[model samples]
Target: MSHRAALGTLAIGGNPLVSRRVLSSVGEWGGARVGARGAGLSTSMASAEELRLVARIATGDEAALRQLYARYGSLVYSIAVRVTGDRCAAEDVAQQVFIRVWERPAGFDPERGSLRTWLATLAHSRAVDHVRREQACHRREQRQLPGAPSDVEEVATSSAVAERVGRAVDALPDDQRVAVLLAYYDARTYREVAAELDIPEGTAKSRLRLGLRRIARCLEQEGLGAWT
Candidate 1:
């Protein structure tokens, strides 16, 4: 089937056989759930209708999935486009977001936040990953060029510093570590991190502050404070 036809299947409903076929067709594009915890809105923030829709989706009600897509498709696509700066990439990210929901509807925990927030977070995360991969590919291509600059000593020093930083980050508490990584490694702003992790902006800032302070202390203890 053409790519558009394949994507069209994402919204198809009412028949178990057709649903399974569509799922199988889209299975080649793997997906992962966003399970990070954030100090944001609580279960009370999610509406009863949204919770019921997710429950129905979990039971393989493709019509419920269609309802979900119709409700949030534009939002997801818009977020993806903003992050990736490519309409085509945005479309791909949006499709993957819905596919993930279809495959693992149970992953949506109303206790964490609203379904709309969850979908937005998932879309942003996927878009960031897409952009990161594209940049990595571009970097690889640059490195392959004949006259690409190479500095052995600088490379070694950078590698050592990166290793130490990685170790320091890993030593952080789970929640702080996620916040720190999202803010630093993922190049997300404090607001973006809050949105992506479903945390309030203040909470996101606090996590970054605490995480960075801890990492700085760690580096100081190791005589690497200058690097921090």
Candidate 2:
């Protein structure tokens, strides 16, 4: 069975995604079967409030941690997936976020941000770390590979977002764009980016500042200022 189907089956008592198949298959599970009733319940899959559970988790409540996962598992998973672009890595990032939350609940200062936002930050950081590590490994492999330049060009021409980013990157005034891509997209440290670009650290700082300001202005002029 598909993962979603298996997840739905395990969630039979709690999930709202139940289908007629589940209704019919109920009796097949023997003692676990209920009345085989099929009245649609208007209940949300996100049945618990994440903040409240997080609060309880702060006090070392294990059940609250489980409830928090049930409430926000998909949200956390989604952020990791989007950031990492790898299912296995996303799963690992999601697991790590929760593990950290469980181990040091007091580390979460709700005053800094909402539980959801904090979780997103954690997911993003983990994904960024993974991406950087992968990039470093790729750089090493590229050094050993011959005729890799042709593959890079073909890959750049293949995707819409990649093409758009390529244009934006091309438009950038060398230094600014290099730093922006290095720090933001490659997820490298500003100091590291500066070192890689063969420029002073302050120059890297200036590049990021100028690049971001330009991007903000351009996006705003295009009526995407809300994202800025």
Error of 2 at 35 (Å): 27
Taking the tens digit of each residue's C-alpha lDDT, what string does model 1 give over 76-128?
77667756656777767777787778877778886666687689889988888
Name the best candidate (by lDDT): 1
Supply the global lDDT for candidate 2.
Answer: 0.54
Q: Which residue window of length 10 is worst by lDDT in model 1? A: 144-153
Count of backbone clashes, every candidate in sequence: 0, 0
TM-score of each: 0.48, 0.47
Candidate 2 lDDT tens digits, 105-201: 6776655555655776787787788777878777643222112222323453443333543455556776787677656534667897777778899
lDDT of 1 at 116: 71
After superposition, candidate 1 runs with Cα above 4 Å error: 1-46, 140-228
lDDT value for model 1: 0.63
How large is the C-alpha RMSD of every model relative to the true structure? Answer: 15.6, 12.2
Q: Rate the local accuracy (lDDT) of all candidates.
A: 0.63, 0.54
